[model samples]
Target: MAAPDDSEDQDALYVLTAALLTPARFPAALGDDYPESCAALGLDPYPGGYGLVIGQDSDGARWTVVVDDVSLVAVAIASWDCGMEYDLSPGERTVVSVLPGWPLDLAVAAPGLPAPHDPAPEPEPSRDGSGQDGPTAGTALRLPLAPPDTGTWGPPQRRLGADEIALHWTQWRDRTEAEDAEATGTAKRSEVAKEPEVTQDSEATGTAQGADAPGESSENGSPSPGEISHPGIRRVLGELRAYLHSDTAPPLGRVRSGFAPDGARMLRADGPGWSFVARTDDMAFVLLDEEPGEVLPVGRGSELPPLLKALDAMAVRPA
Candidate 1:
């Protein structure tokens, strides 16, 4: 996995943070699927995956050091998550590519470094839209990697929204129950239990998800009286069902499962223009590019329960 040494006279990278670029887990902002995500970083979709070490070089410029040492980076991330310190200095032999800038955002900076910024530009021949201008193509003029713009509704934001829902599934679940009770004119289910009501802005997940998605209304997002069926929902469901078949399955990691509370499995799946998040034992939420900011709710009825089971059966999980 070694790369041509284009980084001449570069100082040691002061590691700030790191992330895994793998099939089962990756930064969703890059792409919906593993191959697409690797393409975004100009790397091969190696089954073993790559480790993205984000840090500032001696020059105070940000760089993403892509290394083949997946286990090392994984351990570092685990240590950080546990509030333990782990030095993540990859061996020079494991260096794959040293890319400019970061594909993901990081608030932390090295103590003594100046503000994080892009490296000095040394422009090479610009390429056509495809980026293959000549034999000199891909010869180390690494462009600064930037996070996808999420100011408006798009694929990047849609994936991030799904991430938030998964991250705060319990809050959303409680909200769904409340919404159903409100729409049905029945006493709230939690009234006897007296569970605190949750709104989208629930500190559980950072930004305000609000009661409804930005463009969504009760008429579109809840299963209270009758969950309105959309053509897009039907389309996405069909695609997901197709993925269950061996011959029709999507790429690796397109369908993935993660740990959930109470013996449930959290499922996150993405496709051409949509992302789906669900719990194996609960209902699912659908977000589509065509329908901006709307998070359509799918009830756990006759079909959905079985479908979610099938998805979990074939879905990949963290090792």
Candidate 2:
């Protein structure tokens, strides 16, 4: 298949966390030009895990360089160990470690062909020879990391182990924004007091950290966010391909994962549509089609059974 076209778009890569972060203070903390820098590097500054690469941005001061791949931004979130409600300000430079789908180049660039024993088999006829409406096997996007530019920085390895992949950072700043309403020198100190303990169990399921995942870095200037904070979660990068393709109970695609630092409520997207949203401790919501505003509450996580039932209902059928 032909690669996605990139000639028409004007977006750049390399988004400064400041540009993308909200509740507004993030921009002040990082810098005003951060979003512009993100555009220079082909990064989409929009909120949430999904982002698109358009070009490169640099003025030489804040967030110098990087490429933007939507999935990668989500993965980067894990590396930052940005807990469910924690501040992500410390992760400004962490984007450098995100290398786009470079390792899967061979597979991605390869021509499409049917599998061996590849002769097209006739579809089994239904009751009156009509084709059955069984689920059709299809391909999902599996992007390879783009090769890093000569001077660019990136993580050392391409994948991670199980437990190591589950790490994430969280803080309840938003929940406590009201508490800091009074005279405050800087809300930083008070934020610490209000910080909620992120029990690991609240994360999306199957996000176990991989103890043996590799931990190599290309530059010493700044450590990869996950390396310093959530090494195990960082390892999940290594298992990206596996997670997408594995025959698992609750198959998933891009998901806004959240968890208590302890590993309890693992939320994940469940769907028949191409998109789904599942937050571990909150709720599983599916946006089957946005044009029509079709939304549905698949399950709830506060109580485990409802969550599991929702997940089971959403699980992909085994081949």
Candidate 3:
């Protein structure tokens, strides 16, 4: 077996995180001997002090378990453009943790992680359209037990429930709307500054002509389907939606999501072409014609902590 690269680790982490966070029940195989177990799963344990165990569940979700002699330290899951992690403690016989944007009803538990520290509550939109903090408590389950063999790993078998699908769609819609508002405001300001002063007669005639012009065709008046409503949120929502519905999840090494200080959602994708921050109702827009590998500036100082927080929570890199 060969040592895993960052991408491999990311993929495995995403699978593990999803399994741990969701309500699905899949086979979890465990082994006391790290190298032996990894070998069974076609992996080699890392040379670092931590014992690395990799495996796949029946649903095709890849899992990476990091352990020390005394306890399981962490687990990760990856599929497509998403990855997640959960830190564990040996002392806790049972642990419960919540994924930030997910509903409390979907919280899942594992055996190894210690009790999670209470994070400050984030206000989320309720069904009534009022802001309410989601409950912290989630459903509980045991950590993956050792499977009989390594070849048992396969893709997820179950489709997401309506509630699960709704959660994702709502989040995407809210983020997109926020991004669009900011972009619209900026565009309006730019247009105002560039508009030439017209004579009263010309202004009157122009208004009348515009009124008679059959209100521009929908195709020309509205944004095209390919155009993102907000450049700041960029492709984060699109990428996430695709990942959720994909039969095979891809390795998403750079995309991450979280909440802002004012309790608004935020997402960021740091790709080779462009890196941007999309906060609820605000964004750092990029030109459509921007070249690949172009390093665009994002938020700074106090404005950046939330994005960093989201990235860190997603475990884009090692915590």
Candidate 4:
């Protein structure tokens, strides 16, 4: 694929945004785990992880420059999060592979560049769809990287819903409580003290985390979700238990732990067709491919609290 040089010339690669492709952190569009994600980009899953520097070449063709220098990209992301401008330019030596297109959707684009787009495919060596040249063969062409379709609900979309829930946990949590209150004919909001916010997103989100499901109240006086005999939730909980007892889950980052406000640990776990997000101190929201665009809440019931603690003990944490 075409790439630009380090010169501050007009033809240099124009940096737009970046992300980490590590065991604990990666775009959901790629895959649920590290090895699967690396395979999607045709790269090996190295222990140190790679940094994806998404940008446009001089022609405004989108490119994802994979680099080995994870710290450089990490620092740039941190700086940008703090509203500080830091020029993100990965050194040539750190460049691992220059992928064809952007994996995740981006709302921002570089100014003075043509709209970000995939570079036109180089004409393929003409070959019929016979035994040697078919899609499953070695000579077949590879498609450019792109984000998953938002119109459909699948594994990628499921993970994305989980991501949004984790980002807007407080909004979902409060709404869950309010919904439970309405269901039980009581005002739970006025009676309870609010804790520190888990995370927030200003972006408009109408998601599964807000879905109302049938569940009994926990001893703590909050609705306990997923304990209802919903088949999907039951299957998910079963799979989670397998991960703990039998070690039957994916090894490379199917479950991860992140920092949460007020000394809580935010957990993100993904399975074949579902995603799970919760806090050790609070409830959980599950998104499943079968349900399609709906999040099911699981409160801190007696069973769930211990399960969450076990998962947290096994989850991978950011260094």
RMSD of each: 11.2, 23.5, 20.1, 11.2
Pitting candidate 1 against candidate 4, the one with the higher TM-score is: 4
Maximum-lDDT candidate: 1
- The residue ranges of model 1 lying beyond 4 angstroms of the native Cα positions read 1-10, 122-140, 186-228
- Ranking of predictions according to lDDT: 1, 4, 3, 2
Candidate with the larger lDDT of 2 and 4: 4
- Give the higher-TM-score candidate: 1 or 3: 1
**What is the C-alpha lDDT profile of model 3 across 1-319, one tens digit per residue?**
1334434533322222322211011111222123433444333443232333333322233344434321243233333125433442233223222122211112333223322223234433333334453453233322332335323221110111111222354454455456657866776677664645566866766753223233231221223223435553345434534444569643333344444456654543333223334443333322112433222222232333444444445423222
lDDT of 2: 0.30
Query: Which scores better on lDDT, 1 or 4?
Result: 1
Per-residue CA lDDT of candidate 1, range 1-319, in tens? 1111445445878888999999889999899888889999988999988999998876779999999989999999999999998889899999888888889878778876678998975445535566557666556465688988888899999999999999999888888777776865554343455645566656665334323433233332354213446778888888899998758668878988999999999999998899999998888899999989988777775567789899999988877
Candidate 4 positional error at 16, Å: 0.5
Question: What 10-residue stretch in candidate 2 is worst by lDDT?
Answer: 154-163
Per-candidate TM equals 0.79, 0.23, 0.24, 0.80
Higher-TM-score candidate of 3 and 4: 4
Error of 3 at 267 (Å): 2.0
Model 4 alpha-carbon drift over 4 Å, by segment: 1-11, 122-140, 186-216, 219-227, 247-249
- Which of 2 and 3 is ahead in TM-score? 3
Tell me how candidate 3 scores on lDDT: 0.34
